[model samples]
Target: MKYFLWLLVSVALAGSISSCRSTKRIQTAISKKDTAAVVPVVDAKADSMRFIHEIYQAIERNRIDFNTFSAKLKVDFSGDEGKKRDFTAVLRIKKDSAIWVSITALLGIEAFRIMVTPDSVKVLNKLDKVIQLRSVSYLQELAKVPFTFQELQALLIGNPVFLDSNIVSYRKNEKTISLLSATDIFKHLLTVSTDDYRLLHSKLDDVDVLRARTCNIVYGDYVNKNALLFPTYRGITVSEKTKVDIVMQFKQVDFNVDLTFPFNIPRNYKRQ
Candidate 1:
């Protein structure tokens, strides 16, 4: 049951132990030759600032806003030991309030039901008939990094996490733009489409060089619904000592819909 909980939280707080390949690619892209004639240093600096501002604006323009969000998801998880598990999950969230999830295993048997809020974490394990409740800090402990309910909510809803405006550099290709920003906690490299500014990928590394923690996220298969563009698929890779991969495909999704979070522990279940 503890392992199961760890896997769930790890997926929500995705990071990676992967190499710095993406960083190298961005550096290479920035140094690529430009066919356009060179301009004065002052004008070039102005153009760079304008470009950065435009990118920030585009990100804000595409941010998802809602009162409530719900989705049916198909999740595939691969662990470090080469074990794989596939399950279906129903997720519901109230903005800045709560997140509820139900995971079902083979033969439609409900395996776990979880509810997380600003202050606490609760889990009901059907297979073991146990209930585990702990303070919100438990999530941070499980992920080995500071985490918050708001960050988890944003991750599930396809919003960028750990993003900062202190952009140090940017690189652009014909189709995509990559911005690298550094903050106290993370060095975040974010990539978005040139045409619509839809998120394409994100790579994060801990600012402290010795920690050796990294995460990579990819977004794809966007669909327009209710006048909003949403990504239906996400791929996450988190690594430090070991690697864990998670893929989420949204089978159905809706926003600003009335919802309920039902969490009732069975009387006979033992508290762990």
Candidate 2:
């Protein structure tokens, strides 16, 4: 009886080991397969303009799942061709129109903190120990955080704001969504997904300005938990060659929470 029990135990242990190895192998293969599939789908572009519009439609129809989110942003300023600014920001977004962002370099020095709500914009230069609260005017100023003030608000609340303007003679080159801006400053372009409607990438070019006016952005790392495509990652570049990458990973998201804005600046913080 003892000999028989020993044999059974050995066989059981061997089966367990074989099962574990098989599971690991399967998981690795799945990972490779998924990566391969996602790469091409993201690259496909029937027409950048239509893709962007489709993305707008998807977000418009699917904005129901937006709530709250948090992510780390990476900004890079140095590019080989002297075209971009090198900086990275890690951003945490709450659906209440609130955002907390920290910007730094690859070496992790010179950190900047920015916080924005529906009515207030607070920028803190942690390295300088200075803070500024100002009125919202995003169309004029460029940053890795908010594409535009309206978009910032939407991002803070987990909504899509890229749909603010209509498609006025959209253009694309398989990898880009170009929108002719009515304004003199912005030449808009955005990269979108095919299998689903999500803004995969975003970019803007100045019609007449030189050097410092162009921007390129890529959005990825989608987490499809709430029946919507939530961009878990975002990258932005200014000036073309040197890239400022902003990376974000969403953590907590709450939907339909009562959010209010005071827009009141603190009396203590100094104004620039």
For each candidate, give its TM-score against the true structure. Answer: 0.85, 0.52
What ranges in model 2 sit over 4 Å off? 1-56, 64-67, 71-97, 102-113, 124-129, 138-148, 155-165, 169-184, 209-212, 240-272
lDDT by residue for model 2 over 174-222, one digit each (tens)?
5543333324445454334444545654445544544434443445556
Candidate 1 has its poorest 10 consecutive residues by lDDT at: 31-40
RMSD of each: 6.4, 17.5
Best-performing candidate as measured by TM-score: 1
| Pairs in clash, predicted candidate 1 | 15-215, 15-238, 16-214, 16-215, 16-238, 16-239, 17-239
The alpha-carbon deviation from the true structure for residue 133 of candidate 2, after best TM-score superposition, in angstroms, is 3.3
Error of 2 at 115 (Å): 2.7
Question: Model 1 lDDT vs. the true structure?
Answer: 0.74
lDDT of 2 at 133: 63
